[model samples]
Target: MRTNQESKRRWRWARGVLGPFAISVLVGGSVSVSSGFRESELQCEEAYAHLEDCCGALHGAISCTYEEGCAGQTPALDVVQSKCIRKLSCSEIEALGMCDASAWRSDAGAPLCP
Candidate 1:
């Protein structure tokens, strides 16, 4: 059995030690989660921009090729594919564009027009 004074002193010590530790952990966790959400939002925006650029390029290429009646022309295909690859990477296909030209051609997927 401890004295009343000793019990009060122990309680105060425990509160002083545990209170700051708990607060620090809560604050740190909140900050980390907030940062992660911010980064994800920025990435989403970038992906959307890339997708729009790729779509515009594809539309232009298709219109040009169709008007010329050369849908199967290699030069038109190369130009369109090059523009598509430039706006996106192979791994970002699902996020940035739909075409998988990089996976289809090993040497022709580097976003360079010949």
Candidate 2:
């Protein structure tokens, strides 16, 4: 048989776990996201925005196409899109913002090798 003390302990633990969430019934209630969690979400949004900008900026300068020779750089920009844009550290993402487009592209519309 569970003692009253044990029941109380379980309730307390549950309260602790659910403290960050809504206290209302399941029918309807508002959740209070912790400030720290909100801040993290904001940071993620900012990072994503920066990453999107990086991809856009890089893709704009790239001249690679199915028939082009600068295809080598396509992989490089893909690196920026798949890796750097999403997984790189914030400082690195910031650096990408300030990077020169020439570094990612040798020449615009360069002819592909036959």
State which candidate has the highest TM-score. Answer: 1
Error of 2 at 59 (Å): 6.8
> What are the per-model C-alpha RMSD values against the true structure?
15.5, 14.5
Clashing pairs in 2: 69-112
Error of 2 at 65 (Å): 4.2
Please write out the lDDT profile of model 2 over residues 1-114, one tens digit for every residue: 999999999999988878645444432432333322333334434443554465454444443222326542222233234333455654665454424455545544321211
The local distance difference test score of each candidate is: 0.48, 0.45
Number of colliding residue pairs in model 1: 0
